[model samples]
Target chain A: MKVPALVVQNLTKTYDNGFQALKGISLSVEQGDFFALLGPNGAGKSTTLGILSGLVQKTSGSAEVMGADVNADAFNARRYLGVVPQEFNFNQFEKVIDIVITQAGYFGMTQAEAAPRAEELLRALDLWEKRDQQSRLLSGGMKRRLMIARALIHGPKVLILDEPTAGVDIELRRSMWAFMKDLNAAGTTIILTTHYLEEAEQLCRNVAIINHGEIVQNTSVRGLLSQLNTETFILDLNESLDAAPLLNGYAVRLAGLDALEVDVTKGQSINDVFTQLTASNVQVRSMRTKSNRLEELFVSLVRGSAK
Target chain B: MSPARIQWVAFSTIVTKEIRRFMRIWQQTLLPPAITMTLYFVIFGQLIGSRIGEMDGVGYMAFIVPGLIMMSVITNAYANVSSSFFSNKFQRSVEEMMVAPIRPITILAGFVAGGVARGVGVGIIVTLLSLYFTHLQIHSLLVVITVILLSAILFSLGGFINAVYATKFDDISIIPTFVITPLTYLGGVFYSIGLLPEFWQAVSRFNPILYMVNTFRYGILGISDVNVWFSLGMLVFFIVLLGAFSLWLLRQGKGLRH
Candidate 1:
């Protein structure tokens, strides 16, 4: 059997103040897989990443990267993993290219070998033009991209991005998403922790949601979404309604004079609701889901775990 | 590349980055020491030494030259590493090194090397500045090289320790202000310890900086109030002890890791 790209077994972390941040958290990511780690604030996602990257020591348990134990074989383990932390950790006064090239050097790449790689990543991230500028001068989106470029400069087999697109504009976020997709397509295993559920649902094949230092839910995105028995969508009508509309065996609530929310169960289609609404002489103008399916599942699972 | 080669590359990269950091700010890192040392030469060596005439049978300016150079070396070396490492911590950029594949010793050595570079660089600059005020001769080139290099290494390690324990910018400055400056001034940088009373001379022996300054003085003037061999042994002892202590702090991940 092929070795997993990353693995955590019963990982636990308790800070100096006796506050436990991670509690027996276990997880694995296969090679070439795009995985999402979802959690609320302080849910151990960053802590787990920190442990894997050797920034935070684990209180107990073990983590392995590309079959190398993180604690015992740290050099080899780190050799296969690249991390883009949630914060901008590079020296702001350093030139952009120097930051990326220097990061490659930290992994043992000589300047002769790292320069081309740095250039390539910088160009791919659309940061080549600003290579000589100090990092402090870059825009927020550019800095985010620079961090990604720095992480990729070493060409590690696995990449872990902690909120890589946090605070990014929609356009820049989409561009980064495309770039990451291309990276995954090139066979780099990626583990991402993000608050954007839509991004996770769109990009990741598998996901694990943690809450209160425990894995509350772990499954393929498809599997998790499939567990949702019903979905609610909002519909806008062409004309204002006088009162609530009756539909056959369908629950509907009037949100406004011209809008209504309808709950549709599994195996039922919005077309069926349209058919019933047409029979009631209500013409629909627009329709949208009340929330992303993954978001709904995340909130419910986190709430359930809270109890 | 082999793991050893990779480790070397990482070490060299950190050293290079640190050197570049200070050099890039040459006005701040390199210029101030030269100007300050020149002022010391003008006031203490020229004006004060002219009045004193001679110290320990050597011309006063020449006697204080070695002490002045040693002072710059120690202060610059300590300042470089302490401020640089503390800045890395303040900016959270040390995480880059903490997460790298390099061993903790390599990281410590890299920062120390940067400190030594700045220390030696500033020492040489100060020595050249002293040339205008006094003619200098190297009494023993071997001693000159060893003492200067050892002083740089010792203080660089000292600076590394200070940086490790520092929690804020103010903490980094506190030691140099309260401890380093006083010890350096009292280290017999200006006056010979032989001029002190018996009890004060005994007390000065306990000050580690006195050994460093007196050893460098012997290197330059072939005159030392302290035994050269004892000073050498003390310098080596402090280097080993502090080196080990700094390495221990790195391994413990104190201040740099969570």
Candidate 2:
């Protein structure tokens, strides 16, 4: 049988202060899959990443990368995994090129062998121009890109990004998304944890939502989105309406003088709402979802798990 | 590459990076010790030595040179590792080493090697500075090399341990100020321990720095208050004990891991 990219079996972590961070969380990611592990803050997402990367020890159970146990075969396991932590952990005084090249050295590559790869990654990430500059001198977005370059220097089979674009601007965030999509397409398995639900919806093929140290939901993105019984969209009308619009078999309410909120159930065609709106003499200007679909699902799942 | 070769590459990489870190800030790492040692020679060797005359049948200036060299080696070695490792901890850059596939021993050795390099580097600079103050002589080349290298190893390990337990910037400074400075001064870097009364002389034996100084003095002046063999044994013993303790701490994930 082919080995999974990452596997966790009954993993648990309890801190020294008697607080349990993880409680027997199990997960698996197939090779070359784009996976998302979503959780609210203090929901064990970072702790799970910490355990898998050998930064934090597990109190019980096990985790493996490419079938190599993290505890018993850490060297081999780590050889297959790369982690971009939530915080910037490289030396601020070191040059960008040095940081990426040094990381490759830690993986046992000579400077001669690491230089070309470091250069290529830097160029790919648009950081080659800033290669000679100290890391602290780079902009926030550039620093984030430098971290990605450093993590990818060893060319690991599995990459875990813990909020890789946490504080980035929209343009930079989109560019990072495109880069990550290309990376995933090239057969590198990616597991990301992000607060931005839109990123998870757009990028991840499968996802696991963790709440209070447990896996609350694990399913393909399509399956999870399919579970949504209804979706709400807001429509801006060209003409102001004094009263709420009444549409047969659809719940519609006037949100503002010129806006309407409509709830469309699963299996109900959105075309029905347009037909009803046209018949009611409402001319729509623009339309948008009230909230991201995955975000709604995430909030509901976390609330259910909390209870 | 083979696994052994890979381990060597990682080890060398750490050492090289560490060396570069210090060299990049030469004013902080290399220059201060040279300036400090030169002041010591002027105050203690030139200004006072002429008044005190010869010590143990040698010129007073010549007598104190080895101890001063050893003193430089000891302090710089300890300071280099302590400050470097503690800064790595504070900045969280040590996470790079923690997550690597390198063995624990290799990590420990890398930091220790960096400390040794700085220690020995400063020692060489101090030795060259002492030359203008006095005519230096080595009683035994073997002892001179052994004592200098062993002292560097011993204190580098000492510095590594200090960094392990340190949680704050002030914590790293406390041991060097309260502990290392006093021990080094009382270690007989200037005068012979025999000048003290029998009771004080006995107390001096327990100070590890005394053995290091006296043995290094023996290497230079052919005179020592303590047995040379016994001093060598103590140096080796401390190196082993401290090295083993350091390796254990790394494996336990003491300061670097969680």
Each prediction's DockQ against the real complex: 0.82, 0.78
Write the residue-wise lDDT of candidate 1 on B130-224 in tens digits: 88998898889999999999999999999999999999889888988999899999999999998999999999999989988988899888899
Provide interface RMSD per model, one decimal.
Answer: 0.9, 1.0
- In model 1, state the lDDT of residue B60: 88
Worst 10 residues of 1 chain A by lDDT: A241-250
Regions of model 2 farther than 4 Å from truth: none
* lDDT (Cα, 0-100) at B177 in candidate 2: 95
lDDT tens digits by residue: candidate 2, A189-282: 9999999999999999999999999999999999999999999999999999998789998898999899999999998988999998899888
Which structure among the candidates has the greatest DockQ?
1
A1-307: candidate 1 lDDT, tens digit per residue? 8799999999999999998999999999999999999999999999999999999999999999999999999999998989999999989999999998888888999999999888899999999999999999999999989989988888889999999999999999999999999999999999999999999998999999999899988899999999998899999989998787988878999998899999999998889999999988899999999999989889999999999
lDDT of each residue in B1-258, candidate 2, tens digit only: 566776788889889998999999999999998999899899999999889998888888988898899999999899989999988888888888777798988888898899999999999999999998888888898998899889999888999999999999888888889998999899998998878999999999999999988888898889998999999998999899999999999999997664
TM-score of each: 0.99, 0.99
Give me the iRMSD of candidate 1, please: 0.9
